[model samples]
Target: MESSLLLIQLLNGLQLGILLFLLSAGLTLTFGIMDFVNLAHGSLYMLGAFLCASLTLYSGSFVLAVLLALPLTALAGFALEKIVVRHLYERNHLDHVLATFGLILCLDTLAHLIWGPAGIAIPLPDTLNGQVELLTGVVVPTFRLLIIGTGLLAALGLYLLVNHTRIGMLIRAGASNRTMVGALGVDISTLFSGVFALGAALAGLAGMLVAPIAEASIGMGNDIIITTFVVIIIGGIGSMKGAFLAALLIGLIDTLGRSFLDDLFKLLMSTEAAETAAPAVSAMLVYLLMAAVLAVRPQGLFPPLSR
Candidate 1:
């Protein structure tokens, strides 16, 4: 395998992992603390992309669009929690799944109505649309680098927010034992609402960042939502640290497998056989890893430490 190609693939894998981390960070919090299973989380992602796309077009500034879209996505999350999700919190996971599944359809249709059926493409300025060379013969898109940086910053911010601040203390407490936190005079309802909104914003950030690379289409979140769930599951359900590391691992595995598996397979079998099997196996790599992890450590590679 060529070294340059390998490096490029490695970077691509890192980018994918960053996106997964962005989506999963907030989700793990919501899932771990509220015990809420929100299938509609992906809808927030789609909503963010579309919102950013529209705002970018109107303002002629991609950066400004993202800034504006974040609060809107958060507000959307807050409203959903207040109007719908809060009611279902007392119900079981099955109910959460069914309700959120219905919510997916509702949000999708709403997006379709407002944005129309076609995907909206976001335009980047020349400064970001160009390419940069990390080294001789190793050039990558400038926007991709921006994505990596933005995601890492977001992750760092989340770490500080969850570990250093007072709310972080509350969040950690809530994750460990929400009932105890509630009994201690903390307003569980407010805490849950804030968490859900935060999760939505994070998911939205993922969507906004990706909109330029891939047009923001209706139901775009449907596919990614599944992968995001796999990520959180592979990481411990409520562990931020688990989610970050696991996201990167899955990202590298999926990206590298797709890029290099065919070459490896060719060495082991007939070219035609390798060509066919490579695609199938590459697609299944993430699932296979998840299965292996589940078999050995059902709690995940980095289960959250108990308080």
Candidate 2:
């Protein structure tokens, strides 16, 4: 029974890790390449979920809603870059932070105005509403499996884009040296806008995909944004490979810790003590890990090359 439970928890961790990756990949890319501090990126994610939910309801088709939401989210991202973000690029990090923070407030207010203060629940398609059995009769939700699959696919695509494509090369170059890339005749402004849009699109997709399982709520992005920051920090900022690995590691650690920490504590302490301590301790695991990483490797697990 214990082993079976452990397996289920591990699967849960994998699912969570993949979702984090989907959200963190774009964040790392945008920050790494454009050197933009976009706290409002999470708003893009919220927008995706809200748009998907609304469109799904209006169109009466889950697939159609998702397909439509992607482009819309990308366009929103582009407009944001053109209108708000471009001005901040020449400013200092503090200014960028302040501007993006303000944007988050505005986006949240707009979302509430459009979608209402109460959160909306995204209904899963009937086909993905149930569980599927894995080996040894362990069952997991189909929606979770779908999230994991989509996240992994996104990571793979991102890996290829960054390491193989022309724009990706420019992005990496920009990350290492923006002035040099600009001097080399690459259109830096266009590149930044493109990367920002791409990041927003990825965040949107994550929001849309996870909405059915997690539920869409006001300030939902706040929690995930923090998690995404931890993922990127632990994985090494600007390193997609690091983000992928760190995201999975954090996910597994968090999920398994939440599921089994009480049992582990019970082995060493009274039941009541274990119960009281388990939640607090489990919640601290990721932050503790982050602190440990920062203490030992301030540059992150896989620091990008400095130009």
Best by TM-score: 1
Best by lDDT: 1
What number of backbone clashes does candidate 2 have, counting pairs of residues 3 or more apart or in separate chains? Answer: 0
Q: How many backbone overlaps does candidate 1 show? A: 0
Per-residue accuracy of model 1 over 1-307 as CA lDDT, tens digit each: 2898899999999999999999998789888899889999999999999999999999999999999999999999999999999999889999999999999999999999999999999999999999999988899999999999999999999999989999989998999899999999999999999999999999999999999999899989999988888898899788899999999999999999999999999999999999999999999999999999999999998888872
Let me know the TM-score candidate 1 reaches against the reference structure: 0.98
Whole-model lDDT, model 2: 0.89
Q: Report lDDT (Cα) of residue 45, candidate 2.
A: 94
- The Cα error of candidate 2 at residue 243, in Å, is 1.0
* Candidate 2: tens digits of C-alpha lDDT, residues 82-173: 99999988788899989999999999999999999998888777898888888676888888888888888988888899899998899888
